[model samples]
Target chain A: MNLSELLDNRDGQVYRLLFYDCRPLLQHILANYNINDSQREYDCIMDFYLYLRGDEEPFAMLTAIKSEKALPSWLKTVFSRFMARRANHDGQTDYSDSAFDKIPDDEEDSRIFTISDLNTAITLIEQINTSYSAPERVIFFADIDALASNRHSTDEIISVLHCTEGNLRVMRHRLKKRVQQTLAKLTTND
Target chain B: MTDTLIYKYAYNQCTPDERRAVRDMLVSDFSECFAVVGLMKTRAVNDIESSMLKAPALALAVSPKERRKTLEKGRRGLPDVDACKNAPAPKALPDIAYDEEMAEMSEPIMIKEQAFGMSMYFDEMPLQPAPDFLGILNRYLQSE
Candidate 1:
């Protein structure tokens, strides 16, 4: 059936269809979090479900959507917002908890960071270097540089840094964790 | 995402840091670049469709590809993303954060400066006409 028909469902079949169609995307989002408790996980899912199904605004937004293919990405943002809201409600302050800490500010999607904010984040990231040879600073700046120039290559990075694939993986994981910590600090300090 | 935010992002009208943050999201998060692109596409298509609906004759005159190109080019008043990387460091504006609230509050006061100033002459002196008047008139008439 077309998106219009799916959207016109009166028996809540739309949510069911959406849930199944976007299950993999939702599952992928959830997998990043470290929610160990089954009950909390279920609660998060149920809350997100209610958010989508109960809100008139979300439904209204859905009406403007022309393609079913776009729904997954649009819903991805919705699910992301819900996750941020859940994290905020939980009152979790520690950045070491899980992947949820990656998104420290619930309003990050809409937040406009200034150059000063980027500089501050960069400084904090640079400070997190565990060793002189560590590639966090290089990698972070490299990625940002790449964003502008559209020239990022893993092979180039490895060759320049004289690091192996295994070492690069470990360093990236470390850098990711540090970046999360820096992001959390930024939100709190602001 | 808010319409303004989506529009700014899709049309490259947001600040450098704002663009960087969104790009960082794509890189650091769940590889949702494709999905994010889809979302942006939805917003863009809605805008294009609405404009086409408003002017069916104009829409018929322009091919879809040409219309899309015009939309992207016209709406993007800023430099391209590649140019942004190489552009000189932006001289810092006032320290106030450019949040949504600030945007709303400042909207009334944010007057754009004219690119050219009015001609200067003595009050008693007759106004000397500019050499480029005919060119300017032609350009203005063509735009209309």
Candidate 2:
């Protein structure tokens, strides 16, 4: 089914596949890792998707993902597995279901990242980041590292995140709202 | 998400009731969750770089001398009348005798006479009065 149709009938298997197969795990990974920064995580997620789609060079995707520095341990593990799988297949089966299936379902509960979930999150992140401002993008990036590094405090985050006090406040408020809107859109479809 | 709700939430401009509604939506909706995640990512990245990436210096470079030459050529190529017209008008009073002579003369003779008279007047006077005659002369010149 088309993307719109998939979104509209939220009960459909495809939507279920998208959610159960992707969203829930992605959310768990982000929350578990405390990846509070949306932008960098979003980029990492997009790079992961592009890597899955065979639309990006593996080395480039790896480099970009590495730069984010906030990738959850599970995500890194899944990525290594994905890389191994890709190598074994010689890039010929980049989009194959088998590749995604290799990620064990039980491992998901272990907070082990699934390639499928990362790919899906990457896709969603790419779609939303295109509409965000520069400052918003930075905060999102810093949030990933901050969460990963266990650093918390609006002032400290604002300093490391490189935004003014007022701007940080505004960005924090606006970003949270936009995230909610994007989530609604993703699920609503029509 | 509701636009009003999103706007309110974004600005922290929301009431407690609105904030609670936003929190509820964020918690219940997967789409909202992902969006929040994405937005947060964007904000994080924005911290380091916000300006559009610049093209390489070689691509943007234009030598100062080259720019100056271009500007000079542009100035030279402009119409003479436009250049002359834009000069601040001289603050001196009108040459009364010249004005009286022109007023007495017929239009056609005045035109011909003034053609030579302008050069003579300009040469003779250290400071020329704002050239009120120039406007009429320019119109006549254009018709020719």
Candidate 3:
């Protein structure tokens, strides 16, 4: 849907929800990415809001909004694709056939995080921690931190990190796998 | 679980079962849960000493100009600092409690009284009572 159309249809609920819920989710994402400066994060959030609403040119706006000199290539690509899809829906111009037709077959299998998806994961993690043993809780925390840090190597993760090898291996084999599966399920639903 | 237990759990100081019970209570009765949370938050803020609770932006609410004027006026209108410092502290409110509804309704009447007092500053003359012209006529009628 067009930005205006979405706003009109949702009657400000979208903006309210974005500020109330999605802003905190974005903050969490930024924290995971090690972007801790509050002002920079605030600007990035405002930039994202303006970009989504079609108020500014996409790439130029992103450059002005982000404090970093260059964003990760993967992030830039994802953002561009998101913008292109939004532009197309907004009826500004159609994406090239090449752009429209190229779907990543891997996306069907890969996990992506959405705001609600992350909230549910957090809730489940809390529940598990409440019900689990102390060692199990430590394992859960390690796995969650590992996931947030984007470090997927189980063996390297075990040795370099402080937790016992057995616990780390169990966490990697079982807990991490469960988290990934949960994330995949959420992505599919989204 | 009780509200006190829920408040403790909210602060992450409760046992696992207590935490679970608190969470279950919150999930079922969210409004009451949030009220407990709100009270905890208020107490937390209050526990921080005033000097330690400074936020620079919030200080702008009382402008420097207004602050200076207030100080100057206090100097001129009020008693000397040493005398005021030596004076006994004001008495606390008497140890009496009223119904909640009466307390709530009392505020507006107090506010009206304050407003009436403020109006005297704008008006120079003191308020006078209305003349009673009918008193003489009533006296004459009674004599007849």
Candidate 4:
């Protein structure tokens, strides 16, 4: 069941093409996050693979947002998106509700820090981002991923994004607020 | 992990931060490190299996009933728990305010809008990206 062999299967074919086409995107994203944890990166890539298999939303955005001038850069835009999502942590924290009693500062809850937890965190972030405008969400997540990957300051992000510091602050504020709300929901569900 | 460390360490090309990181990884992951000599001795650049080892090599789509058969043939890869025919149903996600919408969204999804007396496909992108779209998948995957 090696890659060379799996290339014969439909899923394998899709993965092979993906591996070829998105190598740079994944490499850049990999350099930023999950470099120390290759397995987690693998799982994240596999998740994308399944979606490619499914022909599923954001995936089709590549074609949906097609315009002659924008077509070529669309792939880069999409890569920026997921790379942002994967790095959504951005050193953010939410207040734990009393309903979810305060966890002791005990040993690590590896389960809570596992790859699945990160997946759930990503899901919650996406759910919260649903109401935001497309451009806003893209900038927000990409900025967040930038923070995680580059450990950049607000000043740096503002400069890199060619946006004002006020705009960056507002984006960070909105992101943190959404993260808190999502954490509340996850807390109740957990 | 071992291969990564060995390559970085022996080359002496690591940045100060990377050197610290490698030290930390070594302290934290002693057991997972490969034997430096043995790994080098056995590894050949021409080995396709070695190069593709980290790639999603196993391509499988099987009902639980057939999973056992597959396992009988080879149990070397990551075990797919859902492949077991008799495995218990996945626990339902606890009902939250948006539970129904979330559950419905677990399926293939689309966002449709009617505007200006017409059905406008605003952000009507599907997750089925051609040539493997990553960001879109993460967007939809996180939502699911």
Per-residue lDDT tens digits for candidate 2, residues A97-159, read 454344333332332121123323333444443444334444554453244334554665555
**Best model per lDDT:** 1
Model number with the top DockQ: 2
Higher-lDDT candidate among 1 and 4? 1
lDDT of 4 at B140: 26
Off by over 4 Å in 3: A1-122, A130-134, A142-170, A183-190, B1-144
Q: Tell me the lDDT of model 4 at B11.
A: 27
Tell me the DockQ of each model, to 2 decimals. 0.01, 0.04, 0.01, 0.02
Q: RMSD of each candidate?
A: 26.1, 33.2, 29.9, 26.1
Clashing pairs in 3: none
Of the pair 1 and 4, which is ahead by DockQ? Answer: 4
lDDT by residue (B21-136, candidate 2, tens digit) is 76666444433433344234433333222211121111122234543544454422212222333444323322211111121231211124343233443233232111312222
- lDDT by residue for model 1 (A1-190), tens: 3333333321122333323233334544554455533333434554565466556667766677775455656777777777877777873323233543354433533332222333343334323321212134344444433332345545655543434454444445555544554545665686
lDDT scores of the candidates, listed in order? 0.39, 0.36, 0.35, 0.36
Per model, state how many residue pairs clash.
Answer: 0, 33, 0, 8
Q: Which of 1 and 2 is ahead in TM-score?
A: 1
* A1-190 per-residue lDDT for model 3 (tens digits): 3334433222222333233223333443344334444444443443454454554454343344332222223234434454456445652211244532342335444443332322343344444333332223334443333333344435543332223343343333444334445556654665
TM-scores of chain A in all candidate models: 0.39, 0.32, 0.26, 0.32
Ranking by TM-score: 1, 2, 4, 3
Comparing 1 with 2 on lDDT, the higher-scoring candidate is 1
Q: Please give the range of 10 consecutive residues that has the lowest summed lDDT in model 3 chain A.
A: A65-74
